[model samples]
Target: MIFELQNDYIELFKLIKVLDLVDSGGDAKKLVVEGLVKRNGEIELKKRAKIVSGDVIEIAEVRIEVKG
Candidate 1:
């Protein structure tokens, strides 16, 4: 999936929500806390990690690319 940025960057959890990966921000947070989210292939635990254009996010069997 591709995510077009509306700002300079987006938070990790917000990105998940924007993509409809989870039902709510709290669900996104829980997923992250469980080490279910990956940033550029590495486990990402920070819910507010700044996701910029060109970054890749992976969750479950889905992959998302952030585009400018």
Candidate 2:
């Protein structure tokens, strides 16, 4: 699943909120804590980690590619 990234850049938590991937900031943190999300194949544990253009976010069986 591809999600469009705004401004080709986004702060981590803001992106999570904007994507609707999680219900809220708390949920976002949960997902990260559970190791349900990956950034470039590494476990992303920080819900506030910045996500920039060209970053690949893998969640479960879905892939959200970041583009400018």
Output the number of the lDDT-best candidate: 1
* Candidate 1 residue spans exceeding 4 A from truth: none
Give RMSD to native, each candidate. Answer: 0.6, 1.8
Q: Model 1, range 1-68, lDDT digits (tens) per residue?
A: 99999999999999999888889999999999999999999999999999999999999899999998
Q: What is the Cα-based TM-score of model 1?
A: 0.96
TM-score of each: 0.96, 0.77
lDDT of 2 by residue, 1-68 (tens): 55566675776656666778778988777887788888988998887787887889887887888777
Task: Give the Å shift of residue 14 in candidate 2.
Answer: 3.0
Looking at model 1, residue 23 earns an lDDT score of: 96
What would the C-alpha RMSD of candidate 2 be, to one decimal place?
1.8
Q: Ten residues in a row with the worst lDDT in model 2?
A: 8-17
Tell me the lDDT of model 1 at 3.
96
